[model samples]
Target: MPGYKTHMAGAAAVTGVAVAGIYWLGFYRPNFESMVCLGIFSILGGLFPDVDTDSKGRRFFYGAALLVDIFLIYKQQYRYAAILGFCALLPAIGSHRGWTHSWWAAILIPASVLVAPMVLLGLPWQPFVPYYLATVLGYFSHLILDGKF
Candidate 1:
């Protein structure tokens, strides 16, 4: 299995190619903020599985999750932020290589974006579709690289 750094690098590389493809295909306008957010989500997805382990990866993941949760709280989305915090802390109950590294995690984590934005903003799913795709791609790449499948 590749290390966290390797997985992140691979995800970043894949995300770059994907962003280029999106631009090349003319599916959407080339927007810097959207592309950058996509890339960040992809990288985070790559490292997500390791949050179950007591490693640098887990620390980083929890840190980022907590930061986001804090932002959510500031936005007055208390219930959503609580859910986020709870999910982020879930892996700690297990030693490692458990649910966090499973196939379902890959799907559910990215899929959460589908519901979260709608809950927060009452927006349609169109805007989050690209981010969802990027996250799934990066997450699957990590699992494959780790020989989980």
Candidate 2:
């Protein structure tokens, strides 16, 4: 348990520092509100495993991908993209990192995006690759803090 807590703390600090550094060093102006949000999310992601809260990160993280969802829905007839987003992020709201942390998710979660547009869309690597990477990165980060590492 102590190990878990220790790792969680490390995760928080690391995520925070990394985000903060990126925001500052990327040579872009750090918006005040965005800075605050980044800090909060970094902390939340770190502490995420302890509460076992459903996919809080997943639900919230998708905001960044909203445009992608909309794009897929409109351009590719992949309504499943949005549905996949919903399923992927929805269960996250209550599932906690433990359930979402499974290695199976790294594969299935992203692919699940195709479920809604099953007939309209063919599986493509373009979107799925980045989505899977992000999911795996965040999920694994949670698992590590939870001592599932």
Candidate 3:
């Protein structure tokens, strides 16, 4: 199986091609900030599958979750913070290369990018479509690298 660097590289390459294709096809014209956010989301998705194990990806995501939870708590958004904390523990529910590596997870997990904002902030889901695509493609790249796709 590919390691962290390998998975990240594969995801970056795939995301770049997909973004360029979308831009070339005039589907979307993303700004610099949007592009950067897409890249970050793609990379996180690439690393997401490994969160079920004792890997760097797990630590990175859990640490990020912790920071976000802390911020939510500071803002007195206890409900959101509690939800985040509970979700953060989900990766541990299954074994490595189990549900987290499934094709369904590749789609379902990243759906949070769209659903969370809409549910929590009452934002429209349309604007988040690019992020969802980027994350799903990145996750698929991981599965491909692992020979799971």
Candidate 4:
């Protein structure tokens, strides 16, 4: 398992590669909106996994990030974020070492992310698929660099 320094360095490298890959594949190309969207997702995605940390400030940061996620993506969950977060802390506290480092999240998280807007935004299948795919690619890089050891 990679440590925080290793994870961060690897994630940065992967982020660069992902952006380049999207540009080269013409998924991004000269599209300014796509690039900007990817950038936003990249920032959020990169920090998300590590938010569930043991450090005092990191824990607070994690809680804040969860609130942000709920506020931005699922406001219905916003009210529950802090309360649920408090609950989430127990098991995490019990099993801090091997818990967050799970590979299962890679498959599950992206799948939900891709489907989330179909339910939330009521977007048609056409634009939703490619847009979600792009977002997944950007987000998955962070998961991979998380090093599920």
Q: What lDDT would each prediction earn against the true structure? A: 0.83, 0.49, 0.93, 0.52
Q: What does the lDDT read for residue 143 in candidate 2?
A: 62
Q: Write the per-residue lDDT of candidate 2 for residues 1-149, one digit (tens) a residue.
A: 33444544565566555555665787434467655544444444443344334344434445545766787778774765666466545544655445555656444544533342344555555533322333334444656555675
Comparison by TM-score, 1 against 4, better one: 1
The best candidate by TM-score is: 3
Candidate number of the best lDDT = 3
Which runs of model 4 end up more than 4 angstroms from their true locations?
1-12, 25-30, 55-94, 97-99, 125-149
Q: Please state the error at residue 66 of candidate 1 in Å.
A: 2.9
Is candidate 1 or 3 superior in TM-score? 3
Instruction: Report RMSD for candidate 3.
Output: 1.1
> In what order do the candidates fall by lDDT, top score first?
3, 1, 4, 2
The TM-scores of all predictions, comma-separated, are 0.82, 0.38, 0.94, 0.54
Residue-level lDDT tens digits of model 1 in 1-149: 68888999888888888889878998766589888888888988888888787666788877878898989989998998988888876888876777777889899878877887798789898789888988987887788888889
Candidate 1 deviant stretches above 4 angstroms: 70-77, 93-95
Worst 10 residues of 4 by lDDT: 93-102
lDDT of 1 at 17: 89
- Candidate 2 to truth, TM: 0.38
Per-residue lDDT value at 125 in model 2: 53
To one decimal, what is the Cα RMSD in angstroms of model 1 from the true structure? 2.4
Off by over 4 Å in 3: none
Lowest lDDT sum, 10 consecutive residues, model 2, at: 127-136
